[model samples]
Target: MNQPLHLMTPEVRANPYPLYAELRRRPVCQVEPGGMWAVSRYDDVVTVLKDARRFSSAGLGQSFRPPWLEHNPTADSLVMKDPPDHTRLRTMLSRAFSGSALSRWESSIRAIAEELAEATVRRQEVDFVAEFAMPLPARVLNLFYGLEPSMALRLKRWADDLVSIPASQPSPQRMEEIRHSLAEMERCFNALIEARRASPGEDLVSELIRTEALTHEELLGFLFGLVPAGVETTVYLLANTMYVLSEHPREMERVRDNPALIPRLVEEVLRYEPPGQSSLRLTTEDVELSGVTIPRGAIVIALMGAAMRDESRFPQADRFIIDREAQSNLAFGHGPHFCLGAMLARMEARLGLEALFSRIRGFSLQRRDFAWSQSIIARGPLTLPLHLEPSRR
Candidate 1:
């Protein structure tokens, strides 16, 4: 009887929790915003992620089109694939970047975060997104893989354009930009693969080069996946965490005093401000979900941003509280396609957050210039230009 508030405008993308609060009044329904359906309730969204048999992610690619969306190809991207294909591809890629094998990275990650923090502590001001957030993980990932610094920066820019939510359906111009970026990325990967073939290092690229299951092309795709996933996801996570810290000076100071809290704080940050959001699925056959009939081949998109804030699951879901035992948020994802770099992302956040608070005597948002990145899928700051009171000690 009512149109979901999120469909009204971009408010859901801007501040989804408020909309989630309203939707909780009547959580599950087939929201008809120009024929495409959205399942808002927490249980409903969770089922979509969990039940691979009834609902298929492969069919979801371009399965539903809202009236507002333009000619964006909804083809099955990496997250949309299924079964042996999904498992195989994921394993090949995971072998290279899976965080468990790389626990040793923490020391290096901590060192890098410390260096960035020390650099900023002396100067007393920094744009956390560009100066700190974007570069920290991007450079670290590339360096770990033995990639050149310059190429890493280039790939990061290309990733921003590719993953950036367009104002409307992407223009032909934007598509061209994406194509060129992809080409350049592939070219760089090609060169790297060639080098790895000659004299392999103990890097992800080298490991992938040696993997029997992965072909050269798949290897490229696997590495290319990291191009956006590594840089963009961490960028959002770090920005959100910093914004959280800046707002909650007490919480910020707690972790500052004890660096050991970094891991706990990082988990809470993931629950509070997950970097990755929204996974899509398609109802393979006519099925019932939360009292709503999802027709055959209907597209379903779970807004993790919305699901994480479901009050039924998370009381006072809107509040950003750290050091609590909140369940793992869908930020990295669920089911078969959960983030391969989950561990690394967590370590980076913890180390970076620790280094930041430890070095800066006082850090708070420079609200006058504070701005948010307006993308369809992510909510993070474009520039967290924090003002420092300067480290007295």
Candidate 2:
């Protein structure tokens, strides 16, 4: 009985690395009852991602939901298109999300982090996921789009529903829920796009609206995609990092003392436990990977979480070492389809963690009982209870 790591079994959700290790030992071949191949080894996953000519980013259908859904919002997303189309959409959005553009939000991100940390410090114990991890990204994205924080929260909810559609076995009820979410999202973003067009401001939506390359549908798709791509992923990354730090007090102390180590710690956390575990790609032509022949027109699942732990790629890959000399992890992905919100996520984590640890001296989990989110493509606890020891300083 082969237990595929991509499944959402309770045991796999709790700890999937052992399962991934089992899968990594086999040749890169089909694991799904269907023909979807699981590419787990580090080199092979990189190959699938880099060789876009052979493996297309699209055609797997939006969010891996039922391919026949009429209300699929991600079909026109930049991550779901081939070159020329993908390149054009990415280029226009790139100007809007450029490093310089994102850097301007650093102070605002820090402020949000500080505010959230201050709020948490006053509580005896808090659900960190709800209080800090989730809201920071939502609020930051809200600030980016000039939306009120209230609207940002609603957007996060819609994004969560959108992204979760792929991980579950689809049903009519689920499809209806997805349609509802998409309608609300479209309504929200359309109004925002209109507002940005009337008076372009120093915001992401305005920058995107000002771009000549994107159509209205394309713009809506990008905005719709941003919530899941930006908010949900960031929430998990931050929550996972906090969980990791709690497990390693010594590393936390070191990072708190020297801020320089925070960046490396962030990278290590990404490698050790990426929020997004796997991404789907469609094969455009017959390809040979790891001596296994993958036929054309098949779906290939790039197991990024598994690849990060491949022993050949990172010595002691299973262990989480903050100062590992080789820091080439695929947490933010690689090749042309690398994550668009990678920089923004990193900034939030750094600022969020820094503000968190600095304010609360001795941080620890309040309870051992926690519930992990069930999904094939993402991993993290649904709620993390935490307690902050009084400041020593």
Candidate 3:
């Protein structure tokens, strides 16, 4: 029997389409070392995500499982559990993320997008991640907590430290720094929690505190979550989305022509290059598919990007088809724990892309181009350099 693909290898990380194609050859597969099973074909990937029972999110660590802290009560947090725990947390958090929160922030988010776009245009050659991707969601969500501009930027950094821990064989000092940064986030968020108690604002944080259902720890967990989950995932999505669009200018041209197509085009980009390339879900019980028996507690890194490109589901999967119907991809995940911030993330990508293209005109990669931050769990560009259309001299 042939060995399973080593997903974290440099070559695969650079471009895993070929590896994914191989997985499609064997519909059900398992990787050694971590004993992580991967379902790469579109149907299998979707089924694993859809059925929370047999396949489990608990196999994945807690959403609020602090890297530093030992305990995690909020394993009940939406990203980390199954059935009753996952459902309850998702329900409560969904209420916070609903129309009420996003509706109130529409004007502010629009203004933030406009400002960021304006700044990007001023500098024709820009790095989309820092200039546009990171800031759009960072600043808008910062507004939610009534954070000071400087503190907001620091909070953004803290979130980065938590999510963007590099995979280099670095020193122990570096690891300490990461844990310290997470501690700082806790201190800062606790202060904000106190502020909300004093005088609540019309923001998600304040709204969350008002819920009265969550304890102080739960409230703090949500705040930390809003930092990384809110900022990192959306930022990664924007950067990756921009990279995909810039690489396929013809596809982008289509969107520019039909402005309304921007929304659907965003979906296509997400499926094309998801923020999280792959994620883990453990099997709760022995599950059989395609003559492969996946035992209980087996780790499954659902290869979302590959699933997005499955030829069976997507004809001419390799080609950049902007108008492609993005139904089958598990980009936002599936099941009860489907992404809570899907609407907000989609909105940000739409605004970021629309704002950039409307002003910047043509865009192409420049200098070092995009660099993928190597983590088996997440996939995103650390830096994305692009040469933009220069204003008339």
Q: Summarize candidate 2's per-residue lDDT along 37-103 as a digit string, tens digits.
A: 9899999999988877898987765554465456766766788888878887788788666698888
**lDDT of model 2, residue 141:** 84
> Model 1 over residues 1-393: C-alpha lDDT tens digits?
685444435555555667656665666555434444566666777777778777676754443223333433323345656777877777667755655667767787788789877787676667778778887888787877787777657767866865653234667786667666666766777898899999999777887777767777666656655666678888888888877777788987778777787787777777767766566666778888677677887766676777788777777877877756657677787777778888888878877877777666667777745555555456677788877665566
As a TM-score, model 1 comes out at 0.88
TM-score of each: 0.88, 0.94, 0.91
TM value for model 3: 0.91
Q: Which runs of model 3 end up more than 4 angstroms from their true locations? A: 62-76, 164-170, 326-328, 390-393
User: For candidate 3, lDDT tens digit of each residue in 276-326?
Assistant: 777677788899876788888777777888888898888988876777765
Q: In order, what lDDT does every prediction score?
A: 0.70, 0.83, 0.74
**Higher-lDDT candidate of 2 and 3:** 2
TM-score-sorted candidate list, best first: 2, 3, 1
Off by over 4 Å in 2: 1-6, 33-35, 62-68, 170-174
Clashes found in each candidate (C-alpha, N, C closer than 3 A) = 0, 0, 0
lDDT of 3 at 208: 77
Q: What lDDT does model 3 reach?
A: 0.74
Candidate 2 backbone collisions, by pair: none
